[model samples]
Target chain A: MIEKILLLTVAVLLSGCVNLHVHFPDAADKTAGGEVPTRPADAGGAAK
Target chain B: MLLRTAVLLLLLAPLAGSAAQITLSLGSLRHPSFEAEGVMLSFDAARLGEADIRLGVLRVAGTEYRALKIHCSGFYFDGRRLDCPEGSVRREDERGRDRPALPFSLAWRAEDNFLSFSMHDVDAVAFSPLVKRLRSWQPKGTIDFGLTVEGDRAWLGLAVRDLEFASREGDVSGKAILLTVAAGAEHRGGAWQWNARLDWSQGELYRAPWRREAGVIMEAAGSLSETTLQVGLVRLDVMGTGSVNASLAWDRARGEATEWGFVTERLDLASAMDEWVQPWLGTLDFPKWYAAGHARFSAEWKAGGLRRFYAGLEDARVADGTGYVELGGVNAQIPWEASSPTDAEISVAAGRLGDLPLGGFALPLRLDGSEATVKGLSAPMLDGRFVIDLLRLAKRPSGWHGEFEGGIEGVSMPKLSRALKLPIMAGSLTARVPRIAYEDDVLRLDGALAIEVFDGGIIVHQLRLMDPFGKERRFIAEVTARNLDLGMLTRTFAFGSIEGRFDADLHDLEMQNWQPLRFDARIASSEGDYPRSLSIGALKDITALGETGQPKALERVPERSGFSFGYDRIGLSCALRNGVCLLDGVAREGEGVVLMRGSGIPSVSIIGYNRHIDWEALVARFREVIAGRPGAIIE
Candidate 1:
C-alpha cells in the first residue's frame, strides 16, 4: 500500500514537470562566434 | 570712338590698382544684419588684376577665427554672386591647435541669400574643444562631416565608422561603433526648429565592468521645436535576445517635465542581470544563479523621480549554480505608483526548493504604503498540502519585517525523508505553528511544531534563524521526543536492531554553519511492558561507546558472533559546549559511566570511561558505526 502511494505521488509530480527546462546553458557556448571586436590600445587597460 | 576709349581707360586705372592690392582694415565692420570687430583683410596683387587673399585673426562672439588663405581667379561682384574658385581652410581654435586642412571652393549668392561650401575628406578632430567640457567622455577615431547653410536654414551631417570609448578607470571599453547623424535646422522668429535621425550599429560594450561583452544597436529619430523636444521613436536591440521600443517628450518650459514609456520583450534574465544588474550589486555575495524569462517594464517620471512603474513577467525560471533551487513557470503582474494601492498574484507551476519538491502555489498580494499583505497560499508537499495563512510584510529603514502562520498536515514522512535527504523512517509528519516572524535579519517562531514519526511525537520550540540569507546561517531550537519506538529509529538508520521504547530531549540546541554549537541532549529507555531485544550488532556498537573510543571499541565481545541479548534499560547523555561533549550515562561506577545495564541470559552491559570528547570526533564515530565500517575494537 505504501509503495502504491509513493508511486502515485511520483507520477503526479513528474506529470507537472512537462514545461520545465534547464535555462542556463554553458557560457562559452553562448558566446561562440567571437562577436566582440578587439579593443585598440587607446581603448585602454586591456587585460594582460 | 578713339577719344571715348582713352577717356574710360584713364578713369579705371586707380580703381583697378586698389582692387589688385585688395587691402582693408576696420575697427568695426557691419553688415546689414550682423556686426563684428577687429576685422582685417590683406592679399597680394597680380599684374592682370587677380589676387591671393588672406583673412587675418578676428574676434566674434568670444571665439577667434585665424588666418584663412584663398586663391581667387575672379574677385568681381556680379548679380549678388561673390565667388572664390579654389580655397583651403586650416581649422584652428583660439589656442592655435592646428588640424588637417580641408580643401574646398566657396560661392555666396546674396540675391537668393544662399551660401554653399563643398569640401572633401573633412575630419571632426576640430570639435575637441566642444567635447572637452563633458565629464568622463572621450571620442577616439576618425569622423567625416559636412555643413551647408542656405539663408536662415542650416544642414549638418556627420558619420563615424568606428570609435572607442572607455570608462571605470580604463577597465570598461566599447569598440567598433558605427554612428551617423543627419540634421536640418532653420532659424525663424528668434527660435530654431530642427529634426534629426541617429543610427548606431554593430556596437559592443566590453570587459571588467561587465563579465562579458554586451552587443547593442539602436536607431532613433527626434525633433526640437520651440521649447519642447520630442523623440518620435527609439528602437534598441540588446544581446540578440531582446528588443525595446520607446518614445518620450519633454517640456523645457515647465521644469523639464517628461513623459516616456518603453517595452522590452523577451529578455534573457541571466544576461540581463549580468549586464545591467550585477555591476551595481558588486558588494553582495551569492551563489551563481541563472534565470530566463520575458519581462515587460514601463515607467513614468515627472519632477525628476519615479511617478509610476509596472512590471510583468511570464515563463520565468531561476536556479542556483548547485542545482538545488530551481523554479519554473513563474508569472506575475505588479504595478506601483506613488501613494496608490495595488494588488497582484504570483504563481509558480513546478520546481524544487532546496531538496523539497514544490508545485502549484499562488500568492495573492496587496500593497499599501510600504507594507504588503499576502493572503495565504497552499503548495503540494508529498501527499498533502502545506498551507499558510495571511502574511504581512513591511519595509523599514533597516531591512524588511514579516510575519506569517502556517502548518503542514499529514505529509508522508518516508517521501519527505527522501526529499530532505535523511534516513528513511515510517509513519507521517504533521505540524501546527501559531506564528513566525522576521525582523532585523532574524527569523523567529513563537510556537511549537510537532512531527509524528517512529510512533512518537517530537515537539520543536523556540526556533530562530540568524542571518538566514548570509554566508553562515544559524538555526536555534529546542526539541523533545516522547514514547519513540527505538526499533524504528534503529532500523531507519540501519544502526543494528533494538526493540524498546525511549524518550529524548535536546535543550539549548544551536547549529551554526550546519554544525552543532551548544546543546544538552539525553536519550534513555522508557518504562514499558514490551519485549526488549538487542542484536549482536547492536551490542557490539553499544559496547564501543567511550569518550575517545572507536566504533569497534571491544573487538572480541562475548556476543560478537550472531548472538543476541536482552537488556533491562539503556541511557546516554552529552552536554555539548565549546566544541566538546561532556559524556554521562544512567549511572556512574568507578571512573566510568554505565551506558547499558543487562538483566537476563546472555545479558550485557557497557561502560564509558572518558568524560570529555571532541564533538566532531564523536560524531565521526557514530557515522562510521552507522555506515557499517566500525574499526577494530580495543582489548
Candidate 2:
C-alpha cells in the first residue's frame, strides 16, 4: 500500500507540471434584425 | 347565401307595390352552391305596407329547404330602388324544431347592381344541419353580420358573442369568447384578391398544444391573405402572475411555421413550476429550487427539424426558501442549431452553497448532446485560487456523471480551519488532484492528492465517496503522513508540548456522515530522530490512554526537577472496528506493551494494560489532552 501511494504521489507531482490548452471559436457577428445562421455544419467535426 | 336571399327579397318588395293582382313566374336561377327552380310570387299591391311572400322549396347545397317564408312590413319600391323596413325569414322543419325568427333589413339599387343587407341577433346555433356540415364540433354563439355586394366586389363583417366551443374527439372545450372579423374580396382581371382581419377577446383555451396553462386570458390579433397567414401578436397573462408575447407566420403551401418567436417577461419560477413544469414532468414537487427571470427566445423551423434556436436571459436569480443555496446576477446567452456544439457563456456574480461564500466567476461551456465540457474555470476560495483544468460532465439515461481535474494552491490552513470551525492548525496547505471521476453517484479518484502541511507531506489515496449529494454520504480513504515535526503538530492542537519526529499510517479508513466507522491507525516515533523528550503534561496524557497507568517518577509537583522528562521511544496503535479500538503499545511489557519508555535521569515510563477501548471514549480522552486537563492518570 505504501508503494502504491508513493507511485500515485509521483504521478500527481509530474502532472502538476503539465497543462492542457483549449481554443474557443470566435463568436458570430450579430445583425440589426437579429438574423444569424445556425451553427456551421462542420464546426464540430474538427473538435470531434 | 346573403346575395341570393337579397335578390329574392327585392323581387317580392316591388311586386307588393304594383297595387294589382298579379301572378309572377320566375325562371330557374343557377348559382355555384344550389339551383333554384319553381318560384311563384303573388301579392296584393293595394296594401303595400305589408306583404307575405312564400317560396315552395329552395335547394341549397345538398340540403332541401321547404316552406321558406319572408314576412315584410313598411316596404317601398320605385323604378330605381327597393326598400324593406323590417322583415322575418324562416325555414319550416318537419321535426317541430323551434328556431329563432331572423330580423333583417335590405336595400337594392338596380342602376348600379348594388345590394346592402344587415342582420342582428342571429342565433346561428339553431342551424344544426348547417353547423354539422361545416365542422365536426359544436359551437354555440350569437352572430351579428352585414354584407355589401357591388359589381364583382364584396365586403363582409361579422361579430360573435358568448361563444362556447367544444370538441368531444379532442377533449377540448372553452367558453366566453368574443370575436370580430372583417373580410373583403375583389375578382378582377381573371384573378381573386382577398384579405381578412380577425380579432378576439377574453379567449381561454383548454388543452392547448404546448406550455399553455388553463384559464389563462389570451388576446390575439392577426391577418390572413391569399398566400400567407400571420399572427401579428398574441399576449397571454397567466393569472396575472406571468405573461408571454409571441408572434408567428405560417406558409400556406407547406403548412408549417416559417418564423416564430416568444419572450417571457418576469415569470415567477415557483408559480410557473406549479402551473406548467411540474405537471408536464409528472413530479409532485420541485425540491425548493426556484428562479425568476426574463428571457427572449427565437426559433426558425424548416422542412428539417430545427434551423436555429436562440435564448438570452438577463437579471436572473435562483434561490431556495430556506436560504441554503442562492445564485444571483446571472446572465447567459445560448445559441444552438442542428448538429452543432451549443457554446454558451455564463456569468454569475455571487452565490452561496452550504455555508461557503462564493465569489463572481465566468464560465465558457460547450455542450454536445449528452456531454458538457468546461475549460479553464477558476474561482477565489479562502485566500487562494481554486482552479479546474478540464471538466467533462455527461448526462446518461439513469443519472449524471462527471470527470474533474483541479487543485487548491497556496491556501492558508488557519483561515480554512477558522472558516470550517475546525481546531486551529497553522500551515499553508497546497493540494493537487490529477483526476476525479464520478459515475452512478460514486466518485473515485485515480491519483493521489498530495497536501503539504505540518512541515511534511500527506498523501491521500484510494478515495471513494458514495451518494455524495444524497441524504446519507459515505467516504472511504487511506492516508499516510511522514516525517511530521511533532513539536509543530502538538503546538497546533495545544496537546501538551512534545519534542520528536512523527510518522503515521491510517489505512482502511471509512466515515459515514463525517463520523468515523472503522480505521487502523498507528503513530510512532520516526527512526533516528532528534532530541526526544515528553513534558510532564504530555506524559500524564499518554498514561491516560489505559484504564490504570501511573508513571509517578515522571511527575514533579514541586517543580524542582523542571517540567520535562526523557523518553527513548513512544508509540501507540488503534485497530478500530465496529466502534471499538483494539489498543497496543510500542514495546512488549509482560502481556501488554510499554507505550512510553523513559531513558535517562529522572526517568519514567508508562504501560497500557487495557487491550480493548471504545473508539469514542479514546477520542474524548484526546480532546481532554488538547484542553490541558490531563485528569488523574497517575491514579
Candidate 3:
C-alpha cells in the first residue's frame, strides 16, 4: 500500500496539472436588435 | 441371487463361527487376513514356519472371484526384512512349477502372515511404492489392489501406516510429493458417519512465503438430505505470532427451494480479505464474519476502518460495515433521504432528532446507489458511510452543515430525549403535512402543526422552518396540534438555555441562529398541547391578567433599562430586523410600556416579569388582543 502511494507521488511531481475552464462573451446585444450578428465561429469559416 | 447367497454363507460361516478369527473395521488391522471384515488384515506371529492361511473373498468383479498373486513375507517393526520370499509365488520344489505363482502365495513363512493381493485395476499413486520396492515397471506393471465388489452391503477401505512413496522424479525429496487425495464411498442414498479431524499448525513445518499457522477440525454425519454439523476454530499465524480464531455450526436441509429463497454463490472477491492491502489493520476497519440462508441477501460486514450499510444485490454485495446511502439521487423511495457526500447539505424533518448532532455538529458522510459518482472528483464514488467529526467544523465551517429536513414521520418527538438517552423531554405532536430542506446556509419548509407541551417540553405535529443562507434571512413557524411544554423546550435549544412559557402568541422564537431575534410565529397550544395553551406571558403575569387585569410582573422586572412593553399580545407584522423590534409607529423602553416619548437610553430591552412598570391596563390590553386576533400576526 505504501508503495502505491509513493508511486502516485512520483507521478504527480513529474507532470503538471490543468485548470477547470476559461470563458468569453458572445456578439448579441439589445442595441443590435433584429440585426444579423457575426460570430467567432463564422469568422473562422466553419459556418455553412 | 440364490446361488450367490449360498456361496457367501458357505464361505463366511466358518470364519464367523470361529472365536480365534475376528472381523475388524476397514481402518483397523495393518496387514491382510482371511477373517478381516471387508478387506483389512493384521500379521502378528513370530516364527519361521509355514501355516495354511485361509484367504477372504477376492473378486475381480461381482460373481467373478479371481485368485490373487499374493506376496507373503516377514518384517520387523523397525522395517527390517527377514528371510521370506526368494521370488513372488511358490515354485514346485525348485522345479519351476510356479514361475509366476508368487512362491508361498497363501502359505505363511516365518513370522509374516500370508496376505492377499489381487490383480485388479488400481490407482498408480496408491501402489507405486510397492511396485517400486519390487522393482516393477510402469504402464501395465502395478501392485495388488485387492478386489472389486459391487454392493451397498459393504465398502472398500485401505489403510497403510508409516507409508512413504515418491521415487526419484528428478532430484527432489519425498516432501515435494506430499499431496492430498481421498477415496471415500459415494453412497447412493444412505448415510455415512465420519469423525474426521485435521490440524494445521505453523510451528510444525518448513519455511515458506506465506505463514499459514492454523488448525481446522470438522465432523459430519447425515443422510443425502439432512446433515449434522461440526465445526472448529483456527488461529491465523502471521508475523510469526499473530492469529485469528473462527468457528461455525449449521444443520439444515440443503436443496434448491427453501424458505426465503436461499441459494449458494461465490463470495465477492472485492470483499475477501487477503485480496487487498488494508489501511490500519486493526483500528479503522470493521470486517465481519456472516452466515446467511442464501445469496443476494444483506449482511453487515466491517473490514478494518471501512463500514457500510448496503442493500444487497441478488448476488453482488451486502452489508458494508459503514452503510449504503444516497441523498436525493437514487434511493428517493427510502423514507429517510441522504444527499450524497457534500462538503454540506441541510434538512428540516419532523424528527426531534437530526442525524447524531442535534443542531450544528460535525457530520461525515458517504453516499451510494445506482448513480454513485460524487460529481467532478475522479475518485471512486464513496459506496458507504464514513465518519465526519463535528470537531472538524473549524476546517469546513461554510462547506458542511446538517439542517434538519422533512416531516418527522412516525418519530415520537416526546421520547426524543429518552430514545437518545438524552435529558428528559416529553411531548408527541403530528403534522397534517410537512417538508423542509437545508443547505449552504438555507433552510426552507412548509406545513401544518398540532403539538403538545406537557411537563416542561413542546411537541410539534405540522411544522416548517426554512433557513436559506442569509437570503431568506430568518424563519417563522406556526403549529396547532397538541401538547407543548415551554419550559422543556428551552432545554431543547443548544444555546446557553432559557426557560419560560406564556399564554399569548409568541411572535419571535428561534433556534440555531447567532442572535436571540427569534422567527415570527403564530401558535396557540389549545388542545392541551401547551400547559396553559399559552404564548404571551408566564404564570407570574397570568395571575395579574385575570385579577388586576394586567401583567403582574410588569411591575417587577424592569424591561431592559430604557424599554418597557405594556402589551402582552401585540401584532407581529411590525418592523423586525436582526434584534431590534418595533410595535406600530412607536418603540419601547425597558419598562412594560410603549415610549410615547423617547428615553436617553441607547440599548433596547426585553421585558420580563418585573416591578417599576404599569400592571393594570397591560393586563386589560392583553384581554383586548386575545378577543381580537388571539393567535394572529405570524411570518
Cα-based lDDT for every prediction: 0.63, 0.63, 0.28
Native-referenced TM-scores of chain A, all candidate models: 0.38, 0.37, 0.32
What is the docking quality class of candidate 2? Answer: incorrect
TM-score of each model's chain B: 0.69, 0.56, 0.22
Q: Give each model a TM-score.
A: 0.65, 0.52, 0.21
**iRMS (Å) per candidate:** 28.4, 29.3, 31.9
Tens digits of per-residue lDDT for model 3, B1-635 = 22342344345544533334332223211222222213322332333222222234332211222222223454211121123332243222333333334332222222333232243323333332222232222222222323222232223333222222323342211121112212233334444322222322212222221222223222222222235332233222223222323333334434221211111133332332332222222232223322221122122222222122223222222222222212221111111113333232222111111232222212222243211212211111111112221111111344433433223333454444444444444444333233343445444444434444544233332233443322234544432222334445433432112232322233334533323343333322223221222212332233333323443333343333223222222111122233222222122334332212212122112222222112223434344433423222211
Q: Write the per-residue lDDT of candidate 1 for residues B146-246, one digit (tens) a residue.
A: 56667788777777766666764777776876677777777666544566666665566566646443355566666655477777687777664678777
Q: Which regions in candidate 2 have their CA more than 4 angstroms from the true location?
A: A1-48, B1-236, B239-241, B245-263, B270-327, B352-356, B396-399, B425-427, B540-562, B587-594, B601-612, B617-635
lDDT of 3 at B531: 22
